[model samples]
Target: MTFELLEKLENKINQAVETIALLQMEIEELKEDKANLAGKTEQLQSDNDRLNAEHQQWQERLSALVGKIEQAEENA
Candidate 1:
């Protein structure tokens, strides 16, 4: 092969190697981001469940208080 043709082939090979390296790095970053998102989703679900339980408890308490108040007014 001519010197000029060999030089062109080497440059093309170098470019291909650089592109592959960049793609590999991007894949690793995406995997890390996916894991972080999953953890956040699980934590949010747990918080929502706790809030729902607390709300149910408060409702029961309020109902009992209302019944007591009504009885006192009737007796008075």
Candidate 2:
């Protein structure tokens, strides 16, 4: 309609375009961060599994040792 109104509209359009660009960049960064976090989570899960296996093995060994100690004390 008027020149002033057209100028204001153009400024608003430019700002919207800039805001959209910033939002898109932020979204990309978040996606990358999520991928990295997922990979780290998988690695931690693997480590936990290995540790659990080792713990079970150690528990069995300890139980056997305790049994032997009890038997020795009984003999004494």
Candidate 3:
């Protein structure tokens, strides 16, 4: 091949290597973002579970209080 052709091929190879490196860095950043989002999702799920349990407990207490009131009315 001519010298000019060889030089062009070398330039193309270098550009490809640089592009691959940049893409790899972007992939790593994306992975880190995904990990952070997953952690936040887990924390939100835990909070939801806790709130639901408290709501259920309050509902049970309210139901018990209502039953007592109804029983007292019947007795009176």
Q: Compared to the true structure, candidate 3 yields what TM-score?
A: 0.84
| Candidate 2 local lDDT, 3-71, one digit each (tens) | 999999999999999999999999999999999999999999999999999999999999999999999
Q: What's model 2's overall lDDT?
A: 0.99
TM-score of candidate 1 versus the correct structure, residues matched by position: 0.72
Candidate 3 per-residue C-alpha lDDT over 1-76 given as tens digits, one digit per residue, 9 for 90 to 100: 6999999999999999999999999999999999999999999999999999999999999999999999999999
Cα deviation of 58, candidate 1, in Å: 1.1
Model 2's TM-score against the true structure = 0.90
Clashing pairs in 3: none
Which 10-residue window of candidate 1 scores lowest in summed lDDT?
1-10
- Each model's TM-score, in the order given? 0.72, 0.90, 0.84
Candidate 2 residue 16 Cα shift, in angstroms, is: 0.8
Pick the winner on TM-score between candidates 2 and 3. Answer: 2
Deviation from native of the Cα of residue 6 in model 2, angstroms: 1.4
Looking at model 1, residue 52 earns an lDDT score of: 97
Q: Provide the global lDDT of candidate 1 against the true structure.
A: 0.96
Q: Which scores higher on lDDT, 1 or 2?
A: 2
